[model samples]
Target: MKIKNLALAVAALYAGSAYALEPFVIKEIRVEGVQRTEPGTVFNYLPVKVGDRLDDDKAAASVKALYATGFFKDVRLEAEDGVLIVAVDERPTIFQININGSKDFDKDQLKKALKDNGLAESLIFDRALLDQATQELKRQYYAKGKYSVDIKATVTPLERNRVAINFDISEGAVATISQINIVGNQAFKEGELLDLFSQTTGGWFSWITKDDQYSKQKLSADLEALRSFYLNRGYLEFNVDSTVVSISPDKKKIYITVNLSEGKRYTVTDIKVGGELLVPEDEVRKLIRIKEGDVFSRELVNESTQSISDRLGNDGYAFANVNAVPELDRDKQTVAFTFFIDPGRRVYVRNINITGNTKTRDEVVRREMRQIEGGWYNASKIRRSKERVDLLGYFEDVNVETPQVPDSPDQVDVNVSVKEKPTGNVMAGIGYARGTGISFQASISQSNIFGSGKYLALGLNTSKSSKLYSISYSDPYYTPDGVSRGFDLYYRKVDPTQLSLGQYNTAGVGSSMRVGLPISEFDTVNFSLGIDRSEITLLTGAPQNYIDFVSAFGSRYTTLPATASWVRDGRDSALYPTRGALRRVESLVALPGGDLRYYTLSAQNQWFYPLSKTFTFMLNAEAGYANGYGGRPLPFFKNLYAGGIGSVRGYGTGTLGLKDSNGDALGGNRKVVANAELLFPIPGLKGDKSARLSVFGDAGSVWGSGDKMSFGDLRYSAGFGLTWVSPVGPLKFSVAKPFNPKDNDKVERFQFQLGTLF
Candidate 1:
C-alpha cells in the first residue's frame, strides 16, 4: 500500500476508540447530533452509501464533504459492526439580525447589505461571518463620511441551535470639508477655478447641498471638471499632479489639496485629414471647428473627431473611428493636427427594443423611433429618436444605446430605455396668482391614455370673479404621418371690475378645432378655427370706448375667429431651459362673416444661453399689432393688454395700458413686452434641477388704438424670482420694484402663478 493510503487508514481507524472504522462494508448509515437538518440530507452528503465498501479514503472524503456543507461546525464518521455512523455538531442558524442606534442608515438597509454579503437570518452562523457583517456596517458608515463610527456585533445562542445577532452602532458626526486649496494655477484666479468645482468647503448652503461632506467620488469628479476647464482653454498638456485629503484629530474636519500643472497654451498651426476618406475631404475638413491659427482646444479636437465619425455614420458606418494626432512644436507653442478616419463595417440594426414604460404601449414608442430595425444604422436618427421621445413629455428621462450583436460583426441592436413620469392627473387644487387671483381648479386628463399616446382633458376653473369649463382632446398621430388633430369646447364668464382691467363684465362660450403639421424636426404649424358668442355688461366705471362698443354692436355679438401659429421650439428643457431659442409667430383674423372685422399679428422670440457652468442668460421679446379693418373696429373685449405677472412684474395686472377718465385701465390694440433674466441654481439646491432662482428685468406696455407706438413708453421693472417645476405642477414667484412709475400707474411689488396645469 502507498504511504499516503496507509496514513489515511491509520488516521481513520484511530480517530476514536469508542467508534473507530477500518476498511469495512457498511450495512447502514445513521446521522446524529442534527437538530434541524434532515437525516436524508446527511446521507445525501455521504460519499459512500449503503451496500458500498467503506475504506479510509471514503470515510475521510465523507467527513470532509459533510463539513463542507456548512450545516455542521464539526463532522465525524464512525463504523460499528459494518454500520457507518455520521455525527455532526450543527452550526446554529441565525434567527434575526438587529441593528440599533443607527440614525444615518435604516436598519432594514443594513440588513440587506449583510444579506448581500452572505450573512442573514436563517443562515448558518460563523464567527467569520459575524466579523464580515460588522466590517460591512462600518464601511457603509464610512462611505457617508462618518470616519468615527463604531460598530460592535454580539451573538447570542438560543434554543434549537438558533442564534440572534445585534449590531450596536455609534455613528459620529460626519466629517466636513473645512478647506479646499488649489495650487499652481496661473491662467485663472483661484476663485474662478474653484467656481468650476461641484465640491466646496463649508458654506452658507453646505447643509443642504452637502458640498462640505467629504466624498472621494465627488473629489474625482471635481478633478475631472478642473481638467476639462483647462483643456477647453487650450492648455492641452494640463494635468492634476496629486491630491491630498486630511482629517482632523477628531475626524470631524477634512482638508483637501489639489496640485495642478497648467502647461503652456498651444495654437493650431495646421489641420489636415488623413486615412480612409470615404466621404469628400472638403466635407470632413469643414466639420473641424479648430481652424489654423486658432487656439488649440481639446474640446474642439474631440468635437472634430465625433463629427467625422457621425458624418461617416450618416453613410451607414456604425463603427467609424476618427483619431486626432497632433505634432507639437514646443518652442513656438503650436500644434499641427491630422485626423485619421476608419469607417468600420456598415452594420444594420438587428432589432429595436423598448423598456421601462409600464403604461406606455410599445407601439407608441416604436412609432417615435427614427432608426428602424433591419435598416442601416444612423447616429443622427438614433439621437433624433431620443429627442422625439423626450418631446413627448411622457418620460422624465430617455436613453438610447446601440449594442453590437454577439458574433455578428455587421449587426447591432437599438435599445431604448425610458423612465416614465406621471402623464395623467385627476386632481383638484386651489392657488393664488397675481393676475388671476385666488383660483380653484379640478382636472381629469391623460396625455398618454393606456399608453396609446393620445391626450384627453376635462377641466373646470373657478374664481370669485370668473369661471371656466373646458373639454379638449388630441390624437397626435391622427394621420400616422405625424399630423395632430384636436378640438376644444369651453364656456367662460369674466367680471373685470375686480381684476382692475376695466369696470365691466364679459362672458364668452366657444369651441375650436385645431390641426398641427410638423414642418421639420423642431418646427410645427398649427391652425385653429372657432366660433364664439360674447356678451358685455358695462359697469359704473366702464370706459367710454367700452360703452360705445356696447351701444354700437349691441350687448351680445357672435363672431367667427380663425388663428394660425408657427413655433420652432429648440430649448433643451421645456422647464428651466438653459440653452436654445424658441420662436413663435401667430396671426388671428375675425372672418368676414363675423359681427366684427379685425386682424392681429404677433411674434415672440426667446433665447436661453448658458453664461457659465452656474448661470444662464435668457432673453425674450414679444410684440403684437391689431387694428380695425374694412370699416369695422377691433372688439373692445379683444383688445391686447400687457403688464404684471408675465410682463412688467412691478406693475398691476394689465395696468400698463391706457387709462380712461373713470380711472379704469382700457386695454389697447398694440402691445410689447421684453424680458432679460439671469437664471442660476438655488444655493442649497444645486442637485435638484427642478428648482431655480433668477434675477430678471421686465419692460412692457400697451398702446391705445389712437396712441403711437414707442419703446420709451414701455414700463420697466427688475426683481428676483423663484421657479420650481414641482411634482404637482409649475410654480413661479416674483418680487419686483418699478424703475419708473407714473402717478396714475397701478404698482404691485409681488406676483405669482400657482395652479394645477395652469
Candidate 2:
C-alpha cells in the first residue's frame, strides 16, 4: 500500500511539471517524405512559423488538416532545438483499373463513365467511393439481366504514389426465360399470353433478333402491355396481383409467375351524350362505330370519341373535347359508357403564324397550311398539311400549335415550327461487278436547296460495259397547289460482250417530263412521257446471235415511252424503308421514223412489311413483253436480262434466257421475275443504319425466241446479301446458290454485284 501511494504521487508530480513547462518557440520548420509536394505547401499549412511558440493543440490541428488533404497516410510533428519538423507519407493512387465480370456494358465505356464520376484510374482510392461505384455498376447490370454478377477488385500500390487495380469479375450465365406462367387467364391460353411479350423463347431467327436476351426493362414493359391488353378487352376489373421472377441456382434459366385476377367480362348497357354540340347530334352519332350492345372495347370507345371531336373541328369548332366515361354495374356484370362532347367556343383563326423556319421562306411554309383566314377550319386538312411537311424531308420535326387569344373568345392564332435537317448530298465512289468489272460514279443532289423543298440531281457513271450521264430537277409544288412537276435528261452508252452480237455498241440520249398527283396521304400517282434515240455500232468479233437481233431490230433506234407509276409510301423515311410499296406500269412504242418499230408493255410492283421490330419482309414481282407491231423486233439495247444481283442472283449477268451457238445467253425481249427477302440486322451492328444484311430468294425466267414465256423454264436461286447505304450511295453484294440449273446453262453458280443510285 505504501509503494502504490508513492507511485501515484510521483505520476501526478510529473504531469504537473510537464504542464508547467514553457511552450517551444519554433526557429525553423522542416518537412520530409514529399517528392511532388513543394516546401511552400507544407509551410503554408504550419500555424507556428519561425520564432513562434508551438503548442500541442496547434500541432494536432495542422496534422489533421494535412491528413484531410487525402494526400498523406501518416503525419507527425517533432520538436528539436526549438525547431518543428513535419513528416508525411503520401497516399498512392490507383494507376490501373480492371473489371472482370461485365456482359452488358463495354469495358471501355464503363471505364469512361467511372472516370467522369471521379473514379478514374490513377486517382487516389477511397473505400467509400468504391462501394458506391460498385453499387452503381451492379444496378446497371441488373437492369440488363445480370443480377447474379459478382465483381472483385484487387488494388496494388506501385512506386511514385501510384496503384494498380484489377477487378476480377464473374459474370454468371445469363438468365434466359424458360417459362412464363399466368394464373387466372381463362380467356386466353398460356401460349397466347407468351406471344404478347417481346421477349420470347428462341425461334428459327433467334440468332438475328436476339429476342432471348432477357432484360428487366423489357419484362416490365411487357407486363404493362399485358395489363392494357386486358383492360381494353372488356376486362374492367382485371388486376395483376404479383409478378415473381425465379432464377435457377446456376442462373442459366429463369421462370416468371404472374398472378392475375380477371374480373367478369362487361357489356355496354347504356350510352349517354352530354355537353354542347355545334354539329347536329345525328352527324356526331354517326361517326361513332360502337353500338350499345357491342363488347366494351376501350379502343373503340376512344376511337369513337376522337372521331366525334374531329367531326366538330370540321364544323369550325377547332377547340373541341369529347371524352368517354364508364360506369360499372356490379350486379349485372355490365358497364354503361357516356361520351361527353364539348364543342368549345367556335373560334376563327384570325391569323396563321409561322416561326422556327429560319432558312425556309415564309410563303413556302404558309402555302402548305391547310387552314387559312376567312375559311372554316378543317382538321383533316390540317393533319394532311403536317404530313406534307414531313414528306418534304427538309425538316427533322414539324409542329403546329394553336394558342388562344386572351379576351378574344372568337379568335385564335396558329404557330408552326420546323427544325431543319441536311438535305443535300455529294457522292463519288468506285465499284466492281462480274460484267461491268470496275465502275466509277459521282453525283450531287439537293432535296431542299435554300429550303425551297425542290429536288435537283446531276450524276455521271462510267464502266467498261457502259457509261451514263443524267441531270434531273423536280418541284413538289410546281404551281403552289401541291402538283408535282419534274424533268430529266440522260445519255447512256452500252457495249456488249464479244461473245454476244459482234461486240455491239449503242449510244442513246433521252429526255422525260413527269407530272405527279397525290392520291392519298400514303399514295401518289405519276405520269411521264419520254423520247429516246440510239446509234448502233457493230465492232469486231461479232456473233451470229447479235447479227440476228440487230437485223430484226433497227440500226437507229427511236422510241417514245409512256409510264404511269403508283407509290404508296408509308415508310417513316425515304432512305430507309420500314414499310411501303412501289408499283409502276410502262409502255413503249417505236416511232414511225425509227429504223425498227415495236410496242412493248411492262409492269412492276414491290412491297415491304415489317415482321417485327428488327425483321422485315420484302416482296417484288415484275413482267414485261414486247412484239413487233409496225416494224421489226424490239431493239437489243432495250432487252431485259433476268440474272444477277438485281435479278435471279444465282446466275451471271444476262445469263438466264436462251443460249447462243457459243453457249452465251442472249438477252430476252420478254422477262418475268419474282423475289422475296427476309431482312435482319447483323448481330454486332444493331444500331448501325448504314449497313444491313438480309436473306433473299429469287425466281425468274426470260424469253427471246419463244412466243410466250413459260414458268417451267424459270430459274431459282437463294442467297444472303449485304446492303450498305454508304455515303457514296447504296451498295449490294450477294453470294447465291442455284436451285435449278439446265444442261446448257453457262452462268456461274455464284455471283456478286454492286448497284448505285437508280
Candidate 3:
C-alpha cells in the first residue's frame, strides 16, 4: 500500500477502539437521550442508514451531521453487534419569553423583535441566538435614538428540558440633536434648507414632539426632503455628496453635517409631447403642468407623469408607462422636456378580494366599490372606492392593492384590506359652559351593527335647562341605487328659565322618516315628513312674546311638518374635513290643516381650503327665513335660533335672537350667521389631523317677526378654539371675546360641547 493509504487504515483502526469494538454491518439504528425530538427525525438526519456498514469514518460523519442539526447540544455514536446507537443531549426548548423595564415599547413588541432574531418561545435555546437577540433589542432602541439603552438577556432552565428567556431592557432617553450644519452649499442658505426638515435642532416643544431626536430613519427622510427642496427650487443638478453624524462622549447629543453640491439652476426652455399618445395630443398636452420658461420642478414633472399614466389607465390601459425625460443644456442652464407615453395591454380585474373585514360584512364593503370585478381596471374608480370605505367611519384604516395574476399578463386581482375599529359605543359624557352650569349625556350607538353597515342610536341628554330622549335608525343603502332611508323619534323638554335664555317651558314628542336620494356623486336630495305635539307653559317671568305665542297658538297643538332638502358634500374627510366645500338648502312647511301653519327655509354653505399641510382656511355661512302661511301665525317654536357652538360660539345658546319685554331672548323668524376660521395643526401634535386648533371670527344675528335681518345688526366675535376627535367622540371648545355685545346679550366667553357618538 502507498504511505497515505497505510496511514489512513492505521488511523481508522485505532480510532474505532474509542466507541466501537470493531466495524460491523449495521442492522438497526436507535436514538436515545431525546425527549421532544422524534426518533424518525434522528434517523432522517443520519448519514448512515440501517443497512450501511458501520466504520470509524461513518461514525464520525454521523456525529458531525447530528451536531450540525442544531437540535442537539451534544452527540455520541456507539456500535454494538452491527447495531448503530445514536445519542444526543437535546437543547432546551424555550418555554416563555419575558420582557421588563421597556416603557418606550410594550412587551409584545419586544417579543416580536426577539422572534425576528430567531429567539422566540418554542425555539431551541442557543447562546449565539440569545446574544443576537440582545443586540437586536439594543438596535431597536438605537434606531429610536436611545443611545443609553441597556439590554440583558437571561435563560433559566426549567423542568422537562425547557427554559425561560427573559429580556430585561432599559430604553434610555432620546438623544437630542444639538446642531445641524449644511456645508458646501452656495444657492440656498443653511437656515432655509434646515427649515425644510421636520427634525429640528432643539426647540421649546422638542420634548413633546421629539422632532429634535437624532433618529436614523428621520435623518434619512430629512435628506430626501432636502433633495426635493433643492430640485423643486430649480437646482436640477443638486447632489448630496456626503453626510457626517457625530455623537457626544456621553451619547446624549448628536450633530449632523451635510455636504452638498448645487449646480447651476435650470429653466425649462421647451416642452414637447413625444411617443405614442393614445388620447388626443392636445388633451395629453393639457395634462402637463409645466410650461416653457418655468423652472425645472421634479415634483411637477413626476405629477405630470403620474397624471398621464392615470389618464391612460382611465381609458382601460392599466399598465401605462409615462416618463418625463429631461434633455439638459448645461451651457444654457435650460432643459427641454419630453413626455414619453406607452399604453400597454389593457388589464381587467379578475376578482375583487376583500380581507381583514373580521366584523364588517362582505357586501357592506363590496357595495362601496366603484370598480366591479371582471371589468377593466380603472385607477380612479379604485381610489374612489377606497375613499368611500374610509368615509364609512367603521374602519380605522383601509388599504387596497392590485397584484398581477401569475401566468396572466392582462389580468389583475384587487385586494382590499381593512382594519376595523370600534363602531359600537356605549358612553356617557359631561360638559360645562360659562352660562350653562353642566350637561350630562349618555348614548349607545352602532355605526356598523353586526357588520351590516346600519346605524342605530339611543340617547338621553339631561341638563339643568333641558332634557331629551331620542332613538334613531339609518340604512345607508336602503336601495340598490344608493338611496338612504332613516327615521328619528325624539321626546324633548326645554326650560329656558333654568338656562338663562328665556322664561318658558316647552315639551314635545316627534318622529320623522326621511329618505335620501343620490342625485350625483356629490349631491343628494332628502325628503321627510313628521308629526309633532308640543305643549308650552308660561312661567311667572315668561317673556311677553312667549305669552302671546301661547295665547295665539294655544297651550297644546299638533302639526304635520314636511321637509325637503338638497345637500352637496365634497369634503375630503367626514370626521375632520380639511378641503372641499359643502352646501345644503332645506325648506320645512307645516301644513295648513295643522294647528299652526308656517314655512321655513334655510341654506348653509361651508368651504375649506388648505393653505399648507399644516394650515387650512375655512369659511361658513348660514341663513334662515320663516313666515306664516295660510293666514296662520308662524309657530314660535319653529322660529330660527342662532348663537352657540354651531352658530356663534361667543354667545349663549339660542340667545342672539330678538328680546322680549323682559329683555330675554325670544328666538326669531329670520337668521343669518357667517364664520371664518384659520385652522392649524397643534404645536406638539403635527401631522395629526384628528386634533386641530383654529382662530375664528363669527358674525350672526336673529330677527324676530316684523323685523328685518341685515348684516348691520349682526353680532361679531373673535376667538380661538380646539377641535379634537377623541376616542369617545368629537369635542369642541372655544374661548372668545365679543366685538359688539349689548348690555343683556348674555355673552358666554367660554363654551364647550362634548358628546359621545353613541
For this target, which candidate reaches the highest lDDT against the unseen true structure?
Answer: 1
Q: Write the per-residue lDDT of candidate 1 for residues 1-758, one digit (tens) a residue.
A: 11122223335444643234357677888887889999999888778889999775676677677777888877766667777777778999999988899998888899999998889998989888789878888889878889999898888988888998988888999998888899999989999998777878778888777887888888899899899889888898999999999999999999989999999999999998899889999998899988999988888999989998998897789899999999999889999999999998899999999999999999889888999888899999999999888889999999999999999999999999999999998988887777667889899999998889999999999986689999999999898778999999999999876767787888999999999999898899999999999888888867677788888879887878899999999999887688999999999998888788888999999999999767999999999989889898988777888887777798888888678886668888999999999999998677688899999999999998788888778789999998887766678889999998888899988888886433
Question: Residue by residue across 15-79, what tens digits does model 2's lDDT show?
Answer: 45332224577777888888777888877766668877765455555666677777777776666
For model 1, which pairs clash? none
Instruction: List the candidate numbers ranked by lDDT, top first.
Output: 1, 3, 2
Candidate 3 wrong stretches, greater than 4 Å: 1-24, 30-40, 53-61, 73-81, 87-112, 120-123, 150-173, 433-436, 756-758
Per-candidate clashes come to 0, 8, 0
lDDT of 3 by residue, 1-758 (tens): 00111122334544554343456788878777989999989988888887887766666667677777899887766555666677678999999988989898878887898899889889888999889889888888887789989888888889999999777877777888899999988877889889878888877777788888887788899999999998988999999999999999888899999999999899999988988888999999889999899999999999999999999988778889998989999999999998988899889999999999999999999999999999999999999999888888998999999989999999999999999999998878886554555778888999999999999999998887778999999999999778999999999998877655676789999999999998877899999989899888778877666678787768998889999999999998766788999999999998766798889999999999999778889999999999988877786667778888878989888888677767667788888999999999888678787898999999999998877657778999999999998775678899999888888788889888765322
TM-score per model over all chains: 0.94, 0.66, 0.90
For model 2 the local lDDT of residue 662 reads 59
RMSD of each: 3.3, 9.8, 4.1
The per-model lDDT (C-alpha) reads 0.86, 0.75, 0.85
For candidate 1, the 10 contiguous residues with the lowest summed lDDT are 1-10
After best superposition, candidate 1 residue 659: deviation in angstroms? Answer: 0.3
